[model samples]
Target: MFGPQVFLRLFVRINQDLWPWQVLAVVAAIGIPVLLFRQKRFERRLAVGLMAVAWAVSGYGFLVGYFGPINWPAVWFGWAFVAQGVLLAAAMFSGGVREAALPSGRFVALWLIVVCGLPWLAVAESGQWQALALFGIAPGTTAAAGALIVAVITGPWRWLYLPLLVLWSLFSAAMFWVLQAWWLLVAPMATLFLVGAGSWLSPRTAQSPD
Candidate 1:
């Protein structure tokens, strides 16, 4: 949907414009998951709800507002992100994630690493503080965060929806790589790794009586 030059510029520019959001996204990324691990009554709503906001903001704020000015297809992507946000928000009430397996200690750790690792990736790849692609502010981080959420939560559409997220993860990684954002490559890999790990471990956990 975008040329490499345009995509790179989009990442750099949006990050600069939304610098404060980096702190907020990092805070939410770390806090919300911990609450989810506790399996708090309202944690599910809060966690996924945070993710929905990320998606929507990335759609409207980044894609529609920023990227659209440079690339025409970004407007369509903006709407797609908005739609994805709605679906993600709706997932909170579907009883799917609620019924899905609770995260194992390892699963929780993996998820945390994926979320918390963003800054390192940003500094290493972009080599500029202002270009940090913080979650909710940039598309790649947003998609990775969303995939991480789906990985731990269980539901009827769990399998159905995961591939789409993973696909986005790949797409995001490719986009990052186009700009030589190497550390960002770990995003999709880490996400898919967790997804695979969760898939393998969950069945056994579910079948085990404990």
Candidate 2:
């Protein structure tokens, strides 16, 4: 495994190379939850579509194309990200949004913090603005947001998407631990908490109906 400096350098390079694309990542990251929060069918479909694009772009574009040369394992993760994109595509077309619900206020607020704060966390940890880890372009933020996205929607099929996101959360948490980026752990830990609570609440919410 690479050391913290190498990891930081990789992130720096990625941020620099990706350039203005991070803006799109932010837009997609924010747009997804915003659309889902609306809880309308067409909006939900658009959210899922954007989510699928995010996963695919993050996986293939970042992991395989950019990070893979540095870390061979990331190539596998890249493919898995594409697979997740496929799963989301299936969910969107197969009527998975039918029972989607507004996330609890706590979920919404936590997600807001995660999505809004994560990119800058890289800057705080590395002391370099170029180390920004934007959502859709970075695995940590993407998986974190993906977990929360799955949590807000109701259905067993959504569980298909959770494992990879949680796996990436745990995996990235380890990487952050190795880097002594303790604050970065918040992204993964929050993802776990929100997803667990969302899973517990979603079924009950489905049965009860507001």
Candidate 3:
């Protein structure tokens, strides 16, 4: 396994290589929750599509193309992310998902926190803004935010999108613990909170937007 220093360095390289896309990713991340909050069918569908793009890009672009060289397991994770993207794409058309309305503000607030706060945690840990783990590009934020998004929605397939994200949350949390990057645990904690909230909310929810 790679050490913290190498892991941090890997992030720096990823940020540099991804360049302006990082800016776009953050921008899109900020907008996604707002779109969801609108509760309009078109905007909600757009948000899901964007979420799919985030997963697919981070999967192949970050995991397979970059992180895979150092961590072999990430290659398989990359493929899994790609599969998740496909699943989400299918989910956009799911009957319950497409027509559902977002009736709660709590989930949106949590989603906003994960999407907005996660990238800066990398900057805080590494003391380099270049190391920022933007939402759409970075696996940590992507999975964390994506999990929160899926948790609040109503659909038979809603559960399908969550396993990989939950696994990634646990996996990344373990990685952070190993590195003693204690602060970065926020990413995983946020994800776990979503799982908990979903457990509580999914049962009560009849049909709601993700």
Candidate 4:
């Protein structure tokens, strides 16, 4: 629960600290849906890879490097992110993830990707260049994207990471709570609940007739 200025500073400092990598983060986020929509064979892996980047960076870079200086709680948050990042990496080869969508929900998944990944940094405060909230650079934003991506993973353990992503969203909201950032909390929670519901209601892929 910090102030708006503080939130801005946190975001600005993080963006500054993660300069070049921030570009990579953007590319990765954009690349995911592109790959998925194109029906590329590597889309699932790409999604996981991007998620790994977001989790790892938000944990080690922001939580430790930036947020820790201001928030005492960030250290453990950092470790949590780091652990999740590790899990995401492991997920690639472990049969932990599969193609997104269960047939009827691909649209929803893509919608979430765009909403969470690339919204402008400071839509309300455009004059304040330093107050931007880019995806790869900000933990809350990154976690939002990560949660959405992991939510659709289709495997026996497809839902395995869902809880963690939800928890991360809550954790992000807590950070906003301290800062009284109602704007930030709304998106993540709404997305989390909506996606969870949609995924639950979505039809599974039909099997071919024998």
Using all chains and alpha carbons, the TM-scores for the candidates as numbered come to 0.77, 0.87, 0.87, 0.77
Task: Quantify how close model 3 is to the true structure by its C-alpha RMSD in Å.
Answer: 3.7
lDDT of 4 by residue, 23-75 (tens): 77667766755654545546667667777877887788878888787777887
Candidate 4, residue 191: the lDDT equals 50
Candidate 1's C-alpha lDDT? 0.68
Better model by TM-score: candidate 1 vs candidate 3: 3
lDDT (Cα, tens digit) per residue for candidate 1, span 40-82 = 6577577778887888988888879987887676677777888
Indicate whether candidate 3 or candidate 4 has the larger TM-score.
3
| lDDT computed for candidate 2 | 0.77
Cα RMSD of all models vs. native, in order, equals 3.4, 2.7, 3.7, 3.6
- What clash pairs does model 4 have? 1-178, 1-179, 2-178, 2-179, 121-133
Q: How many angstroms is residue 79 displaced in model 1 relative to the true structure, after the best TM-score fit?
A: 2.5
What's model 4's TM-score? 0.77
Residue 179 miss distance in model 4 (angstroms)? 2.7
lDDT tens per residue, model 2, 1-210: 676667666678887888877888878877876777674688878888898888898899878987788789889999999999888888888887545465357666766777778877777877888887777887777777777666545476777878887788788788788779887788788778767766654534435544
